[model samples]
Target: MKIYILLVITSFTFGFLEKVVSNPSPRPYKAIFNLGDSLSDTGNFLASGAILFPVIGKPPYGQTFFKRATGRCSDGRLMIDFIAEAYELPYLPPYLALTKDKDIQRGVNFAVAGATALDAKFFIEAGLAKYLWTNNSLSIQLGWFKKLKPSLCTTKQDCDSYFKRSLFLVGEIGGNDYNYAAIAGNITQLQATVPPVVEAITAAINELIAEGARELLVPGNFPIGCSALYLTLFRSENKEDYDDSGCLKTFNGFAEYHNKELKLALETLRKKNPHARILYADYYGAAKRFFHAPGHHGFTNGALRACCGGGGPYNFNISARCGHTGSKACADPSTYANWDGIHLTEAAYRYIAKGLIYGPFSYPPLKISPNKIA
Candidate 1:
């Protein structure tokens, strides 16, 4: 895969979207099947009984949107929440939340907060897969998806119809694989890790398509270097290693490199499948843009510092943690871009979701309204 390739795939402006040219038809999406990590997870962590992590599935985690804890990692709704609302479907429930026979006709979320696109063993091999607390890698989530088959659809034809009408939301994943590696101080190993993660994602795409998935959205990672946690972890004495945006060059460079290979792989998938609509959601570009102009979107202070957590310049300390007894929260979370130093603020996720829906980012174009799915 290419290294540090410049991505000129789409042109974007802050808080607004450019026009999208069309091939005249868009899929009439009826439901969503989300499979990623914390960014899109609704309540899987809580249902899994991992609520003890506190940063997720507990108070202050859902302070902004739900006005209380709701298992999401951020202060409010996730990107997928916006996507589900756009389509007029109810919020996609975590697969773990399903209790009875009902209209799952809308689909389920198989995402677990600490999920990695590669298997857990890979991380274990690197001495990095140890779940910081409660855990489920991407493969385990996929296994859960397979087990839900009996409840998701009754007949083969019904299953095909489900996939044809639904959007298979794959990622904002593969990030955890990189995240755990970075946190463990294994930066050099990242280059070798990217391929397997991407391959696992694409293979899952193929598996879903084989089961009748026609439209899919595979989002890339955010600007990891700009996250408050990374800034805290990778801060430097030399200004040269940092970009004008104050993000570390090497970390964001890795993010860009991963997105490049992902784009190329999606292009290959598109060619082989020919008729499948495989869209690469440009999460990195939109996120970096937020850092450039946070106030325009109602964020105050331009602080990448976390709205929760304790100590440190970013107000993020690993030991004290968010949702702990002495940890502090900003007066209003909407003013910040990151929630717990690791995840995004609801305000920021809302902005990025719009760019993905109405964009120069999605291919073959989306016939999307600013607030509604087409």
Candidate 2:
């Protein structure tokens, strides 16, 4: 029966995306600059040598789309990839992989998997030294961008023109800060990190604006309660703790609080930088639709469950994570909302991109100026 359902859902992927790209026309953004964590990471994490023989650089990680691993923490392309496709731009190259001057002319991605909004020093100061895995925080990513700027454009006027034509993606960040806090097993500490995290993101945005960014899309965190890892780690016998969609209410509330604060910060940023278009991408709302109606979205395998991982109710086992031995993948990845336990599948990302591109998901639905489209 499970196999039968999976096959049915696989067929639905083609139909589900028929109208997802209502406006297939391209946008005028000549280049894209992205900053985030695993959700948007194209390849920096793998190229960085952060972990030798990292599981993410193996088979099954990029099996769905690229036909091989590409350092993304999923089965195929991410939301950023779909966004680039919609804009009629090539997939952004990881900054670390740049070898020639022409590499970043189209776009550049500085996002790294497991990156936090706050620096490692902040976590260490907060007594989360044990949780610190990588030092490539948002601040570090900004520094990389700063170093690359001089090479891209020499004069202030040149930079202004170059950046104005580029689209900036600031986040879907700050989640790893919370993730590390969660690993520290301190719910109180986790909640406390919200304010500083938002501030850090705000600071990054301000710096980008100073550097000539005119258009930015800052995304909020997703509903962590609906994630398989959180569901497993925070599982409870208390029925009241779980929401109607089978997600933990407490974790979801945390994500909501973060989103609320982040949105408030973006509101302030818009007021401060009236000249720039600072749009807020409601990743939570875009993703929550799947949990509300999985079947409608062709996620017949359900929303919270992972398409690839070790055995369990959610098909997720931390000890035996996806890309590692003893783990398995679903026959049809397009049928599942999640790919591994942590990241989402290409199908789910397409839906979220659709929401942002043409609908009620973004603050002002992302649209291409008709004249801008060739």
| Colliding residue pairs in candidate 1 | none
Backbone clashes, each candidate: 0, 0
Off by over 4 Å in 1: 1-27, 131-135, 367-374
lDDT of 2: 0.88
- Per residue, candidate 1 scores C-alpha lDDT tens digits across 21-113 of 434234467778889988888888878878447456557778886888888888889888887777667788888888786567787898878
**RMSD from true fold, candidate 1:** 11.8
With candidate 2 superimposed using the best TM-score fit, by how many Å does residue 314's alpha carbon deviate from the native?
0.8
**Residue-wise lDDT of candidate 2 within 268-295, one digit each (tens)?**
9999999999999999999999988999
Looking at candidate 2, what is the lDDT of residue 258?
A: 93
Worst 10 residues of 2 by lDDT: 365-374
